[model samples]
Target: MTEALEIRNLHVAIEDNEILKGVDLVVKQGEIHALMGPNGTGKSTLAKALLGHPDYEITAGEILFKGENIIEMDVDERARLGMFLAFQYPVAIPGVSVANFLRTAINAHRKAADPEDKGISIPDFRTLLKAKMDLLEMDHQFAGRYLNEGFSGGEKKRAEILQLATLEPAIAILDETDSGLDIDALRIVADGVNSLAGPDLGVLIITHYQRILNYIKPDFVHIMLDGRVAESGGPDLAEHLEEHGYNWLREKQSKATAG
Candidate 1:
């Protein structure tokens, strides 16, 4: 099984502060991996760095996508190469409608898939948008509303998944998508994500709580502490963290690094 995205001894820093220290992971096609950790453990930083966030400096290591080293690839270049990240806090663009935003992004993905193929036609774009919106349970009016201008927490999260469905990226990093969602909303978002699961999509789910794991059921679970991945296991790891919390894992990680 080929990995969709593989991080090799990745070390990321911001300004003078190091965040991710020698982290390594792999998300193979059709696999869902959960990244669970306490805050400031570099989970979000890893997602941002993979997306080539400007503030993040890759001080060391490599990110390989489909056997290509993307350490120096620009953010847009990475997106064009079938990488997507669902931000924990989505941005609100007051003037751009959700429909327009999605259409542009889908077209961009299409253009990248085939540089010679022209963008999606307006009628065709609308049809595709309606189909995805229906899958997310978004109202038709949502298509005309400004991007997250007044969306509730759940709405924003679902909107992010909508984009994911439309883009169909090979690898997706979902950053705390369950942060503000109620149980009902979390289920909906998880369903939408699950609908996209197959032989082509690999997901990296980053979260602090395991409640969402109960809904999404990751195949592998990783515990991140301090500034690196401390331990990894099957879904049972999530249950263990939920029961005992991070204190023990933090201590274990500290002792391991100390030795």
Candidate 2:
């Protein structure tokens, strides 16, 4: 069966403040879904909850991945199950080299998948890393640098992309990957994402603006309003949002609530 990530009536909260009121969505492998909304609408909260962040508690509902419930799983467990979240602001690991960080991660994944596995050999890892880097058109020297340490905004995002590539997760939640990027940087990052899109991955891109969507066309667009999904449509929805802001949707929502 094709791997899928399903969120049904997912209610998430941070401390006492509930953020995601009731979110329901499904992303299957080979699909690109965009979750768009203004600030404080719970887009990022949903991403965190999906990945089992301890602070963002899942008060209710179910999260199913590949036909298995993941609500009770730990963060690393969820990652091992082929779920990944690219943060809006990636933190720098000063002392860890990019290659070393990724190698460690891959080894962990290997150990999880099989207890008998000793992990990939260094020569084999280098070969795999080089292949992935070549596919992303990155220089070998880039791997020797510290992970995200003293890197530019574009380079930071690039490192995330490289992580995504190496991990090869079935479902990826990109939380505002377009933030802090200039036009050129955004294009390069989007190009990297576009190249990696295929039947093997299901991508959920969470963002507040349409600037990045112009480059990475989404198969589905969802709009969040006041902690719930108020609307869902094709790529035209994103275009409509760009053309005319969320006021119209807000008006419609108000009407529905009044009735």
Candidate 3:
């Protein structure tokens, strides 16, 4: 069965500040969805909460991944359940080669599933890593480099996609993957995401702008306002957003409510 990620009336807050009031969204495998909103509108908060971030407290509602409630699960458990988050600013982890880091992570997930199941062999890992790298058109030497060490902004984002490609999560939540990327870099990253998208993977791309959507082509476009989805439509909605901007939507929505 195709996996589904459903969020119902989610309210998340950190310390004394409430970021998400009541947001609802559902993403199904094989579908690409874009969640667009202005900055400080709880986009990243939703992403973190979905990942089961300890800092964010779930004040209300549920996050059901593949029909399982993951509100109380740990971050690793979320990953095992097929949830992945690509950060806007990925920190560099020095002294760890990209291949080694990924191998360790994959083995950890395998061990988590079955303590008795031995980890993937080095040869098998090399084969798998090469396949994923080739799919993303990455240089074979990339795997030998230290993770994010002396990498450009685009390289960091590409590395994140490589992780995504290797892990093959069911639901991929990208929190502003386009941030700090030039047009050329953005296209390459988008191409990587596009190549990986298919029947077994659901993508929720959260961003403040619509440029990425031009390349990614989301099946559904959602606009969030004040922590809730204010409107949803097809790809044209994103085009409309590009032409007019969120202020226009806010005014139109306000007038609709007043009327």
Q: Where does model 3 exceed 4 Å of error?
A: 256-259
Q: Rank the candidates by lDDT, best first.
A: 3, 2, 1
True-vs-predicted CA distance for residue 28, candidate 1, Å: 1.1
Cand. 2 TM to true fold = 0.97
Clashes of 1: 0
Residue-wise C-alpha lDDT for candidate 2, range 78-187, written one tens digit per residue: 99999999888889999999999999999999999999999999999999999888877788999999998999888888889889999999999999999999999898
Q: Candidate 3 — worst ten consecutive residues by lDDT sum?
A: 16-25
Candidate 3 per-residue lDDT, tens place, 1-259, comes to 9989999999999996888888889999999999999998889999999999899999999999999999989999999878999988887899999999999999888898899979999999999999999988899999999999999999999999999999989999999999999999899999999999999999999999889988998999999988888899999999998888899878988898899
Worst 10 residues of 2 by lDDT: 131-140
- Candidate 2 Cα errors over 4 Å, as ranges: none
Per-residue CA lDDT of model 1 for 1-259, tens digit only, reads: 5557999899999997998989999898899999999888899999999999999999999999989999889999899888999999999999999989888888787887798978999999999989998888888898899998999999999899998998888899999999999999999999999888888999999999888987898999998877777889999989989999999987886787799
Clashes of each: 0, 0, 0
lDDT pick, better of 1 and 2: 2
lDDT of each: 0.91, 0.93, 0.93
Off by over 4 Å in 1: 1-3
TM-score of each: 0.96, 0.97, 0.96
Q: What is residue 4's positional error in candidate 3, in angstroms?
A: 0.7
